[model samples]
Target: MGSNAPLNVSAMVVNSLESSGIDHVFLVPGKLIYPLLDAIDNSPLIRGIVGAHETGSAFMADGYARASRKFGVCAGISGPGTMNFVPGMAAAHADRIPMLYIAGGISSHAEGKGAFQDATPGGIFESGVVRSLVTDIVELKNKENTQAEMRRAIEGLNWMRRAQSFISIPVDVQKQDVLPGQEVARQPYAHGEFNACEVPANRAALDALCDQYLFQSKRVAFLVGSRGNDAETAKLLLEVAEGFHIPVATTLSGKGAFPEQHALALGVYGFSSHSRAARVINSDELDVLVVFGSDLNQRDSMNWSRRLTGGKELFIFDDSFDSPAMGHISRQGIFSGISASFRLLAQKAADNPPGLPQALQRRKGWIAEINETPLYDHRFEQLGDRVSSGDEALYPGDVVKHLCRILPKDSNVVVDSGAHRIFMAHYWLSSGKGNYFSSSSLAPMGWAIAAGIGVKLAAPERPCVVVTGDGCMMMHGMEIQTAARYRVKVIYVVLNNAAHGAIHIDAIRSGSISEQFTKLPCHSWSAFASSIGVAARVVERIDELDGVLSEACQYDGPFLIEVITGVFPAPNRYYAEAEACP
Candidate 1:
């Protein structure tokens, strides 16, 4: 609970946010938001994080929620400031991150008039925010009405499924006084407080299905996704897989849900996937596929080809049964939370004990087959001899491999969109949940640095690394100053190829030899970082990379490592196929 003494509307809003358990508010301050900013500065429960851009603040909020599994809050002024949140809010919507967006509005009396920074008819933000409210402070003269409106706005924070709430407070009304009044009626269900809406599993029905699929099926596979990637749910998923002798695979968004080093772990399955997982998924021996918390999107399903789930029977356990992914698949869908559903299934397996001596033997055979398969041939490892022969410069793949080997197992890696993302997706081996973070659905550029800052804030003790491209760094490079200002330690690895490598490859595949606007002038990233008071280094050769990274990792503040790599096409089989077509 916040202070109950006499306060203004701005203080009331801040109190409500703090009461809802928001620990930080990312914002870009403006003249209209002075009162709110002052209230936030004075509040002990919430800290204000000032970002270089509104989009960066929104992305930071998104990252905070993704990493901590708690509600995130961000604020901006009206008009252009509010418009700046569109891209980041859209990304959050696509990925199902919870956020609260606060915007300072023009005075109510000036509505429809040409006032400065006026964005009237507030519907401009409706598409981005799931729920919104525009209330004038003067309309609520007493504390009772003001508290009711605030409570109504707070109710929208309860849903975590890509839920974003917007609140627009008029400037004139923000300074109005709010006297003590009766408490508003609390809702029976509050966001992040009650789990009454959590769907429960029917034990009898689940057991019967397991008997048919788990015991009788010749080959069973388990696929987990971001929705069920929590530590507790992951533990139970592993237990059930081990008990039933089932091999497990994960979507790219769900990478690290299952330990990549485990024998049954099949790595990521889909675009740029591990070869063994792809082979197992496309094999004819598989009879049943169990999906937990995956949306089965085109990317997750490798463009939804029949090779993955053509003849197999599907069992999908998700919180929402109306998911569009279930439309085409032949599946018996269980609408339940991942944790509750897995617990019941694990209990049923323990009681029934599907006694099959062949299960372990089959599991061992699959592991052996995957180990012997040359599914993922590391192109960088092949090019190592060439680099030593002075034929080729270092590639992004080489950098990723060295990072995986040198960085601590508990370190968190946040990757931005570009050729580098594909390299890290296929090569970076994650050992635990929350160890990897990315925006695969939105694939927004400039997301890594801001999101990495938020991750560092949420888990201050862990080392957070950001892998981005030159284009991405240029988009939000100013955020490095934000990191330095907060003294948040983050290792930023910039793969500088002096162009949008993915787009360049696309152009080359399209038969255009001359890259027109894709090429960019090389900028000294180390000098730019140093100007912002961040320690930085430039690594031009492969031999210098490991040592530079080691020294950068030991520094106590923000650090940047710009790896000067040559322009090369992204290592994706799909690109090769596209180039071969026609």
Candidate 2:
């Protein structure tokens, strides 16, 4: 819209970002981004700040994007900067969050010419990031041409609901001319048709199938996924379970989709999930597992070949139609997301099916049985309840659990990876699917704290919680400052076990039990968060968790709760090996 002298590619880049509505750039500055730094200093459009690390920078951007549902930008120097951002990029991709990555280059002209610190940015991030590009700032015709290139990059980013990277304005490019450019489309954001699986034309046919196998099955159950976490869908899922007289189980990601406190709601399924949920999956009582968008991976699947053998256990229905049903690939058609399918089920079952009362009763009975299971106890297992009061006490799980219990019940949640993951997955609990997310597959530390920032950004009205562990906090803990700087009130829960809990268990199991090596002394993380302009507290005892969490729920802005819990005992390899062997 406007023109500036000085004529540098960095100025053009910064101008384009500000014009396009990017507010802050999360970064760890390098010589390559000197122009951008200069541009940011000169212009009021974008705020450029340093992060503890590039991953943290990317995570901060991700957090901003998630909380705002707009684009978040992460910038750094080419090689190392790009490398550090890779893990966060992968997390964004896997979770389907949009992010814009800006990296400084040696000189587009010297990319492969061995010009000083030049490295092929594209190949450098091939495996981790979903998309990337490299360009020469100096080669551009002028400011106009530079703006056009920037627009194209933005367009490419919008095309994918994931991460995209652009290596811009090498040192040479920074010295290039700036020319005016044309505008890209000035249209409002569009919500395109969500990719979904198709349903059959004849409702009668689906109803017939349901009656033949589902209604007749003695031990039918439901496994709801994130796609069907809405109120209408939840009610429908509950009704269907009642109609068929089957109990309903969920994944950690699927939690809060089915009210865990309900009689029919069996807790999360997986190695780290509640024993009650695990028992249902492992038992012979489960003859027909009606799955809805629940991708039965390691976090929810325990182990692919073991636990709930899919052959007879699964009755899958999804929109993609790729046969997400365990051991039951469709002969024809794909599965859509659970929304459409759940609606159909609800419509068809308005009559409550044939034997609804008996099914509901049976589900209730099973729930009662589960409630009696002593093995599922987590009452004093975590630290929040034990460490309330004294201003510096919180267990990550306790904060998460309190948030789950007291926050707007319909809120969305995002978690990262850590020993805290197990506690959150197994104990914090949610009412349905899609309400909770974490690095279940990757289990990378530092993921949730940043992800929490993203979740709050993505769904601002809904209360968002990010569950992190001590190890995870260190990785992206610095971003809490970013959240504070941006005025994003994302609730953070850090499990402070004083060590890499999972690795500690793994090391010991491998016969290396050096406490000195595995156990790191506790650090004052809450004070650190406070230093960064956020209200943070630490919890040591189990009883203190809930009350402090209740108090934290009242405040707004970025908040941190550090809970102390021991590394949970590792699952015996006997089961993992059994599946691996045959």
Clashes of each: 1, 60
lDDT of each: 0.75, 0.61
Q: Any runs in candidate 1 off by more than 4 Å, and if so which?
A: 1-4, 122-145, 156-160, 181-205, 325-332, 349-358, 378-390, 512-514, 574-582
Candidate 1 lDDT score relative to the true structure? 0.75
Error of 1 at 578 (Å): 9.6
Candidate 2 wrongly placed segments (more than 4 Å) = 2-50, 61-73, 94-98, 104-117, 121-218, 225-246, 305-307, 310-313, 318-334, 351-414, 505-510, 542-547, 554-557, 564-582
In terms of TM-score, how similar is model 2 to the real structure? 0.72
Lowest summed lDDT window (length 10), candidate 1: 132-141
TM-score of each: 0.89, 0.72
**Model 1 C-alpha lDDT per residue in residues 84-157, reported as the tens digit of each score:** 87778778767777677787877777866667776665434332333322111112324446687777655544
The best candidate by TM-score is 1
